[model samples]
Target: MTVTATRSRAGVLTGVLTAALVCTGLMAGIFFAFTVSVMPGLHETDDRTFVTAMRGINAAIENGLFGLVFVGALGFTGLAAVLLARSGRRAAAWWAGAAAVLYLLVLILTMGVEVPLNDQLARAGDDFARARHDFEGVWVPVNDLRTVLTALALACLGPALAKRTAGVSR
Candidate 1:
């Protein structure tokens, strides 16, 4: 490839990787918030209040702002993976691709497992105590999984970004 074209490709890939890093950090922050603050706060509340609050929060998060951040993070990572796959720097490619795949697991677990639990809790009505009792057991652990995965993705993307910059400098 021409020098200009190669530089452009690296630039775009770097942008994507940076975005992936930001989004993943945001997501990890959200989960970490739940882990450290939200859930713990809920644990102190009455069961009814806990259920109501969780249901409302989950419902509110279904909006555009959250959607874009969540999906954008994944999309950028996936694009970075594709762009870097053919890069001459194998280290950059490997880390970028791994970040994409790691975040995919976070997406899958959110949609497949966490969403279902949220739905069930929403439908629980006056059985708030029981619903929450059942929900917390499964939800909290899975959330931690996503949180860790997102953090790991961030870790991988960091190195990938550094490698991209190094390539440009050399």
Candidate 2:
């Protein structure tokens, strides 16, 4: 390949990688913020609000729509990491890879633990009594796992991107 072609590829790779990191960071932040901000209300209430919130959350979880978005993000993030590796930024690529692994873990926890539970609850429909706190109690820790890991993944990306782009101008 010509020098110009190589340089162009590197530039495109860097931009795309940067965008992926930023997107992941934004998504993680949004996820963390929304959960933290709303969970207290969900837990503290015995009124319709709790059920309403659960309905909203459950609606999001029921058909695995959010899961699809997460899966897509994972795909793009993985591709971005691969591109970084190809550009000789092994450390950044590895860091991104690690973050991706953690993200995947979050997905697995959702699919393995949360999704099935959600499915059961959805099937219960109106019959699911408000007295039952089993879902909330059980999912608190599972959701916490996802939140913490996603936050860590977002935290790690900053340094990774910095190292990767240390000598390159945006």
Candidate 3:
């Protein structure tokens, strides 16, 4: 490829990688906030209040903006990996690939574990104590796992973006 073509491709890769990083960072931040503050604060509340708050949060978080960032993190990271590999930036590609895999795990865990718990909480009737009992133990731990995974994904992307920016192809 010509120098100009290569530069253009690299620029596009940079944009995609940047988007991936931003989205991943946002995901990590959200989970981290929940881990540190939201859950803990809610933990101090009564059972019914906790269940009501969680149900509200689950419903509110299902909007378009949240969905875009949540899904886009994985999409852009995977695309960045593929593009880097195709361009022979092997090391950066590997880092981005690892990030993609990590974020994919986060997605899988969210859908497989957390979402089901959320659904159960929503279906939970007037027995707020029972709902909180079932939800908090499982959801908190799983969310903590998600938070760690997302942070790891962000960490992996950092090196990838740095290597790309420094023009380190190998």
Candidate 4:
């Protein structure tokens, strides 16, 4: 490759990697917040209050800014994987690939498990007791799993970013 083209690729990759890191970090932070604060605080509330508060949170989370970061983390990580592999940076590729897979799992868990549960609870309307009974036990465990996955994904991306930076500096 020409020097200019190589520099261009490096520049784009730096942006992608930076986005991957920030987005994954933010996503992980969200899960951490829920785990350490939101859920625990919800635990102290009554059934109706818990159900209502959770419903609001679920609804609020589907906005534009959240959507951008949520999907951005996945997209950038996946791109980083392909780019690293193409450049024969196998170790960095593997790290980024793992990050992609783990983050994708987070998406799957959210869509397949969490969203449906949230929807059901929101539609429960006056059935707050039933909602709390059905949602809390199942949802909490799955959310915890996603939280761990996000954190792991970020960990993988950290190594990938370091490797990418080293390459560029060289």
Top lDDT prediction, candidate number: 3
Judging by TM-score against the true structure, name the best candidate. 3
Q: Show model 4 residue runs off by greater than 4 Å.
A: 165-170
The positional error of residue 52 in candidate 1, measured at the CA in angstroms, is 0.7
63-134: candidate 4 lDDT, tens digit per residue: 999999999999999999998888777788889999999999999999999989998898887888888999
Name the runs in model 2 displaced over 4 angstroms. 60-69, 127-131, 166-170
Better of 2 and 4 by lDDT: 4
What's the best-to-worst order under lDDT?
3, 4, 1, 2
Which model is ahead, 1 or 3, in terms of TM-score?
Answer: 3
Writing each residue's lDDT as its tens digit, candidate 2 over 1-170 gives: 89899789877766766665666665577567646876765677764556556667778644565545567556666776787777677777887788778777877887899777666655555544542365767676787777888787777666666667645322
Off by over 4 Å in 3: 165-170
Clash tally, candidates in order = 0, 0, 0, 0
**CA RMSD of all predictions:** 2.3, 3.8, 1.2, 2.2
Candidate 2 clashes between residue pairs 3 or more apart in a chain or in different chains: none
- In model 2, the Cα lDDT at residue 30 comes to 50
Candidate 2, 118: how far from true, in Å?
2.1
